[model samples]
Target: MVATAESVAAAPGWFTEAIAELPEHREVESAGGAIHLRCWGRTGTPGVVLVHGGSAHSGWWDHIAPLLATTHRVVALDLSGHGDSVVRSEYPIEGWADEVMAAAAAGGIAGRPYIVGHSMGGRVAAVVGARHRESVAGLIIIDSPFQEPSGESIVRQLRRTPKAHPTRNDICARFRTVPEQSVLLPYVARHVAEESVRDTGEGWVWKFDPDMLRKRLEQGRIPPLGSLRGVAAPVLYIRCERGLVTPERAREIAALFERPATVVELSAAGHHPMMDQPLPLVATLRTALAQWESR
Candidate 1:
């Protein structure tokens, strides 16, 4: 069962309309292989690079990017091993940190664009802020939790059956969030979900490589406390009220930063705010980026 054009009808008008503004694609070279990035807005304007969470691609930001593109040059990327980007033997957080720089440099995003990241991407942004402290304008981390890497999941080692669906309907039916949100806006969810798979003639499979999980698990590296304190740029930390981040944990994450981050909360959203709450998410980014730029 494949989702038809009729399904896109159910999505919000903003999303349907935003797709009309096409993006410029860039294939950035990294140590692993060519990294893919999508850009919108004029070439020389201040750049804002948006990074998606684990198991998701840049398409997750499609609707939101166009809105920000009006004010600043906006770009989103398929980090290595995810989306159409080249696969790696093993995934490293540092490699991803470098990939962000590579994409920005290749895209001609002028002068250390505002680095914004969500979930796992948030952790990667932290590494960028620390690793390239002076190079970045500022670091904005969205709803990324700090879990002890030592408590890594056992599921990564065990192999699970790869599920391929013959149609978009089959893929959409199987779609589920990592933190398992109880509710998903069908249109919003469908749009992101549609990009998550590729046609394999016989069926469609997820774009991300499973090996990325195995390799990341093998490395077992999450940004350490030192990286957090080393960040040179001003920080903006946004969390969702209903996301996996608990109030206590959010406070703890805030305490890790050397400079205080302007924290914002998205009410009634989950880990994947861009997918489910693009409007509020865009508004938060716009407001925070404005305040940062003014400084």
Candidate 2:
């Protein structure tokens, strides 16, 4: 459904108020592009880096970042080929991890930062927690899939294409979730749908490159995320009640954590908890971060 004037106006009061508190925008230079970071909160406090899922951008964190900013230097960056960032010749999990670190450093966020990522972003955070353990104090993976999909599903994902339209409204009209769910709150869905589009000169198009799904096609390999034993930091595995990750899978993934990995679920939330249940997600994150601050 398209986010019309009325729908945008219908955004939850708390959500509108949160986004009104603006953050500083900074440009981070990564390997092949200029990554965009929206930073909020005090400079000397502990740092938090937020990564969005495939085809998503920092805008996904708009209403949620401000809450965390109160106690930490929180920043969310638009990965390459998404949002305002330029597309690279190629994208890799390492490249995305590099962008997150680069953005954090450029924003003057000190300390081994806490990394929070959703979906594909979750995988990126996992990589950081494992490979760059010294750079992060902990990681929170939100509904990231741990199991590989069937070969047919992977092929279908790569071959899919976006439907182009003559106007922004036309595209937004058809906006829907990747793995469609019917229970998403209207205001939340409206906001996300509106943010996912861009006004190109010819017309409007999705903010992400459809080819991002072609990771297996281009690289001929999925990121080798073997055992979760390499991660040196605390882990909080949160799954949305209606998200893509199944409860059984959540247990399996959490089981791999060498250190105790706490798993929690948000009620009334789907794949995108930040959109459907922002407040609950914030509270959970706050509790975890508070411990880090006190330590």
Candidate 3:
């Protein structure tokens, strides 16, 4: 479904207000394709670029971004094939880094900015830091696995899943199963589900090209943990006590970093620390930023 101003206006109360409050920009060209970027805080200010995980849009950072903006410029984008961003026929994890770089350039974000990412986004941030070492000031990875995936293994996983176009209802139903996801349902049903439409008479369909995820799974291999060792910037890894990234694994990943990355485990949170527990996440972020600046 193609997103337009009128459609966005028709979005639900929460979504409309959220989008309205954010500084939205468009037509930022990246190697993969053009993307729609939504930012907050003053341009040229010290900033943090937030990247969300797979199947999630930049809006997932809604709560955290505003709080971060109060102290530092905070930017988030609807990565290609997700949210309001243009869906491309093909893309990869490295390509996402390029898109981020383009958006940063367009926003006139000179010098390096703190790069914060979650899940798949964490992988992208690592790749970007490795490739454009000077452009990233520091890294904050939330619940990301440091290990790379074998290409063969990824391809096999894709082959097992059937490909099909998803409907708005289909997407909503899937999100309904997760407890954390429940909080986002109202907004999704209004903005995302409503915005994602092709008008087939029967009903509206999802705008995202299903092939993007399939292609990513097949071609995307996480960079080796050693690749991150070369990043000179300090690293902060935050994991939920009950999330996928166990304390043991977090420690193991931290040990791989030559610069001695700090690891923080939020006991009250899950995979989505900010959403599950915003206050603690914000406090942790503030402390981390202060510590990074002091050093």
In order, what lDDT does every prediction score? 0.82, 0.82, 0.67
Clashes of each: 4, 0, 1
Poorly placed runs, candidate 1 (over 4 Å): 1-7, 148-152, 219-226
Specify the highest-lDDT model's number.
Answer: 2
The C-alpha local distance difference test score for the whole of candidate 3 amounts to 0.67
The predictions' CA RMSDs to the true structure, in order, are: 2.4, 2.0, 5.7
- Single out the weakest 10-residue window by summed lDDT for candidate 3: 176-185
Q: Candidate 2 — which residues are off by over 4 angstroms?
A: 1-4, 215-221
User: Would you estimate the TM-scores of all the predictions?
Assistant: 0.92, 0.92, 0.76
Candidate 1 or 3, higher TM-score? 1
Off by over 4 Å in 3: 1-20, 147-202, 217-226
What lDDT would candidate 2 get against the real structure? Answer: 0.82
lDDT-based ranking:
2, 1, 3
Report model 2's TM-score to 2 decimal places: 0.92
